[model samples]
Target: MSLTISELQALFFGLFGGLALFLYGMRKMTEALKATAGSRLKNLLAALTRNRFTGLAAGTVITALIQSSSITSVLVVGFITAGLLSFSQAIGVIIGANVGTTVTAQIIAFNIAEYALLLIALGFLLEVAGRREWLRHYGMVLMGLGFIFFGMELMSEATRPLRDYPPFIDLLRQTRHPLIGILAGALFTTLVQSSSATTGIVIVLSGQGFISLDAGIALIFGANVGTCVTAMLSAIGRPREALKAAVAHVLFNLGGVLLWVWFIPNFAQFISSLSPAHPRVDGCSAAGRRNASADRQRAYFFNIGNALLFIGFTPQLARLVDWLVPARAELDQPVQPKYLDPYFLSDPTVALDQVRLELLHLGQRTLAMVEEGLNAVTRGGRQRLNELRKQDEAIDTLHGEIVTYLGRLSLQNLVEPQPRQIYEYLAVGSYLENIGDVVETNWVTDGFKRLESGVNISTSTLRLLERLHEQVCRSGKITLEALEHNDLEQAREVLRSKATYNELAEQARTHLARRLVVVAPSRLDAFRIEMDLIDHFKRIHTLFRRIARLIEVSVSDSRKTSKSG
Candidate 1:
């Protein structure tokens, strides 16, 4: 009995929809896994740039854990965009990610569908009985995995009709034409959005002896190029560094495909021995490919060979990619995400790096502004207080940015000392944000307000306020340096200055108290403004104290470090 064309189309559509469900389920599972492992991943990844081997391991482990290289690459792109991981470091991570991506293919090659239900039971047990969030995440991952295997089984079963279709065999036979097979493989992977998944399907088909070695290699090569579509798509409008990293990933995979395409027969022959097969005897020619045997070793050999071919060459190719894209034009605005950066929390290690950089920017900018403000207030230099105020606002904006970046980073990076550092930076960023407010509040903002009120201060009061602002500004500079260099001695100097600030403030208060005792009502505005000036003097003390505490924490962490060492 022949299936009608329309009926066949309906069946194909249903299969397509099932494939979609399977892909969607995998996506959901990957996301939940990442979310569950978010804190650990963030902390681990946050400190990633310590070395290349570490970075590669990080990429591999994340991809292995997440079971998705596409996700891994997306996370890498995010880090690069945020200035967390540099291009050189990211290249290593991608290498690890390539290794990790092999996990999916390996899983599918296991033919685990018969026991997929077993994991589902374990998944249910963990979901109900487990207390740890990670166990729950693991449960979800297992359940999703069970479903993945189950879905693949159903998909393979559904496609078995092709075995009976002569026309289908004829079409598959045309896969001998490398160009046709390449396009088919690429289109198939692009349609699926998962090179690993699509390639897994091809591997399974090859195992079943439904396709030839030539066709299998073609599909694998096509899948390599096709995988880049995801990286390229995710990286659009990202920073040049991110774009370059994504492009680097694309180039490496594509380069492997190009290199292997020339030597496909040799590769197949070299590998085909591991899964030794009887030559094809059936009219459809199934005998040589499957041999009705499972050869895990062959599968492993394929992965190792492909990985080395790409990773081995990636270092040199990366430089070529960098040259190709180059840097964007100067004066080009940085990429500012409308929402919180997806990549920021996607990899906490990278996000933490970004926050640190932003903080460094804040430290430098605020330090400069505070110094300028000090000169203006103390030395009667042209009142650049307004300029300083604007710089402070820029600092505030950066703080807000860093805070936003950290907030996302914290969600994923909730591990110990690093999380605490993230917290410290968050607070420091907030404080820096407030420094802008402080600059404007006491001096530039309200200073103009006091001047507008037509209140004239005596020379002594003006000189006193000037000295107070100077001391506070100097303390601000020292605290920034102390925090940056982790210098306990420099930090202690802040405490040393505090007593002096308090003494001068007390003297001003005492002198003002005496004047108030003799002053008449006509000097009321003068008295109020003088008090306002005195209030700022006391606030200088408050600001320095806050900065001192932050520095002390850094110093305390250092002592812990020294003792541990």
Candidate 2:
């Protein structure tokens, strides 16, 4: 008999609503885990990608911690864009992420739908009643797990009627064909944007006796391929490294599936032998539980096997992906912010790390301007001065981008010391920008004035200014190194150089003072220009010290915090 309208509504609402809960729960769980482990995760990913094997382990552990391979993929892409993780290292992580994602399917296979409500209630109580931040986070984790299981229960209940529905049974029978099952699985996963969801649904169908183990295996294979869409979408408008990483994900998943497609029956039989039998009940049966177990086992086997197959070929794979996604010519044209990836803003710790890297980029550019500005003022022609001025414009553009990115970062829900870190970065960015301003506004104008008035500085004064300029540039470079490596000693070294710079400034002033009396044509103008240059260089020196001091304070605070923890 044909189903009535009410029955159809029940099925539609239950399935869709369950999916909504599942997605929301997954999101909630992922967010809570990320907030709890964001800093450690960043450190782990950065430190552990020494080789393919370690990278694979790191990827699997991180994905398991957060329970979302999509998020892991996003993190990998962001790290690649920031130059924290190389593309080849990211490929290994991508392989491990596939294995990590199978944990969700394994969790779904347990016979715990009956306790989903209890978990929800306890999670709610803990979330509302707990006083500590971490307690609340754990509570959310529990709630998220509850929602996932509850969603599966809802889906399972909704499809119960399908056991007797002739049309539905016929459709499920078609899935026995490997290609048809794979297609359906891939399409559904693409629409949902979650392989776990597709896996969950497949388990539900198997439990209800709607699909056999062979079809379930095919659908699981397809889900692996479809899940790559998340990584690909994230890589859009990102750097070529990110695109290469995404492409690697696609190749690995698709290749693994292709490797095993023809062995579905054998795979199914092997998985069946490994999985233990489950007793039949009113809503679920031995076959259903067995199929669910087998599907999850198959995922583990598929991803781990693929990781082993490709782990040794990472260098080759990276080369192939690089060849596939060639670099654009415009990569070197503009001075855009290299490390300020918007994807990282979701996790403030990683976002702050990106900001630090961008600051290093900004620091290098500003230091170059300082060195060139000195040359333009003392020994270079009008053309060189104009070029320095243009370079300052680029500095201003980069400074603005850093400030805007930090402003956006400040809006995030920052943890302890992160708020202070943001302020420090803002201060450092402004200082670096001010150094560029010193070059363009003060030093560059002084150069123009010197050129226009035909003021000729004696060789002695030029040599003195050059020495001071060298010292200033050296200090700036050291400060940048401190910032880049978080080296406390380097920061302290910059601060300690203040006395030496002071002596040099005093000597330059003394030399200029002695020149004022015996000067020839435009002699007074020459004295003023040299004095102005000395003063501008002193100003730049002071800014670098200020930046160094900020680094010193930041490093000290971090050490203290670490000790306290």
Candidate 3:
């Protein structure tokens, strides 16, 4: 039968509307699930195994809970890119992801569309009016589940008219050929960018008696291959390991499809034989019964195929994928924050650990700046002075990066100890940045000015300044060590030594003023410069001491928290 323009528009409207609700509900459900188990999930992902079976199990459980294989694969790619997972370990996760996606198909097959509206109403009330945050999140999960079924209901109703439509019947006939059905499945999945959606649609059509078991099976096979698109897209601009993960996903699906393509009819027969509730293929069965049978059979077959292919070929497949995406030669990049991998941002603990490591690296770089500044002043050379200035700039750049990274970390819901650690890191970074500024702006600039003015410091003054600089440098090194190792005693010692450095500075100043009077009148400029340098060394020591105090406080707080716990 032919339909009017309005009927066609209604069909399109229903189909698109259903798809919109379905996608939105899936997103809501996925996000709520993640938020509910955010920390636990992060820990699980972080603890991925090199063992294929363990990796597979982890991937399956995570993806099944989240209701998205593509998401799982993307996470795997990110972890691999961050050097958190080995290439072989990632292969198993990708393999398991394919199986986990079948959970959606199984859920759809349960045929719970009748309760969709009631779920929506209850979910809406709980989400909008519930007082508790967790209750609201639970309501969102229910709302997502309702939306998914409601959308499917709408699409199923719209497509019912096509049961009598000749053109649509002919298209269903074409899908009986494995190649045509496979292509159709791939195209539909690619358009929606979700294999689950494609599989749901297939179940809908099969229930309506618009498609046969063989065609449905073919479509499912193609959907598996099509789902790889999401992981592949995620790999773009990522590291070499990420690209390998994407390639592994593609290879797994492609290999599975190519291996099973010839057995389409046999697979269909196998599914049909195993489905106890499968309705007769004749046109006598009700659409609901037909769909129920079709849904279960497809879900079962999808699970079986993924399981068999992954389990049997995991080791060989891992090797093949590794060979296909060989590791590239390492690039000679500048020394920067290697552990600041963006992927770890999802796990606050992991992210914080990385940030702490980068901060330690920053501490080392800043110490280098201090050394360079001392050499620049003591040796009286423009080359060392210019290098010192450049190192200071580098330190400044690193400090800015660290501050920005810490700011991003602050946006996350951090645990108790995390906030304290973050604050301590921030304070340390600020102090180091200030120390770099002093070394360049005060020491380098003033020393250069003295050189330009032809004012040479007296030998006695130089010796005194060098001794103080050396002491400050040693203290700075000790403070860094204390911070890095969380050495409470060492930090305390650094704090206690501050008074000694202060007295030394005072004694040096008194001695320098005495020598100035005995020196020639023209040497007054040099004497003043010497005193200024000594004052800067005292200030630098103060900054270093402040860092030590901050470290001590952090350690003390950590101890108290542990005791209370």
Q: Report lDDT per candidate.
A: 0.66, 0.85, 0.77
Q: Against the hidden true structure, what lDDT does model 3 obtain?
A: 0.77
Q: Candidate 3's error at 386, in angstroms?
A: 1.6
Tens-digit lDDT string for candidate 1 (1-565)? 4567875875576456546656765765786677666546655666775656678778878888887775576667666665577777788788778777766666666667788778778887887788876677778777777767766666666556666677877777888767777788788878877876676567556655577766676777777777788778867876666678778778767766776688766766665565546343222465634632332333345445655665555557678878988876667554232324555455565565556656767766765655555334433322565666667667766767777677666666353455777777777777766655666666565456445565456677667667776777778778777775667888788878878888877777777776776565435666675677567556655665676787687669857964984
lDDT for position 145 in model 2: 87
Error of 3 at 472 (Å): 7.2
Q: Show model 3 residue runs off by greater than 4 Å.
A: 48-50, 70-74, 279-288, 291-323, 326-364, 371-373, 396-435, 446-565
Tell me the TM-score of each prediction against the true structure.
0.78, 0.94, 0.78
Give the higher-TM-score candidate: 1 or 2.
2
lDDT of 2 by residue, 225-337 (tens): 78777668877887676678789999999888899999988887778788776322222334564556666787888888888998999999999998999988764576788
- lDDT string for model 3 (1-565, tens) is 7988998999999989998888888888877766665445545776765577778878878888878665575567656645677777777787777677777777877778999999899989998999876688789889989999998999889888887888878867898888998888888888888887887788778778777777788888778767677667766765566677778888877877888889877776777766665443523136434555555566456655666667667667778877887777879865566556555565465566567667778888888888767667755678777877888878888888888898898897665567777888899999998998899988898678677777767677677777787889899999988976789998998888878888878888888878777857547777767777887888889999999999898889878965875
Cand. 3 TM to true fold: 0.78
The better candidate by lDDT, 2 or 3, is: 2
Cα lDDT over the full model 1: 0.66
Worst 10 residues of 2 by lDDT: 278-287
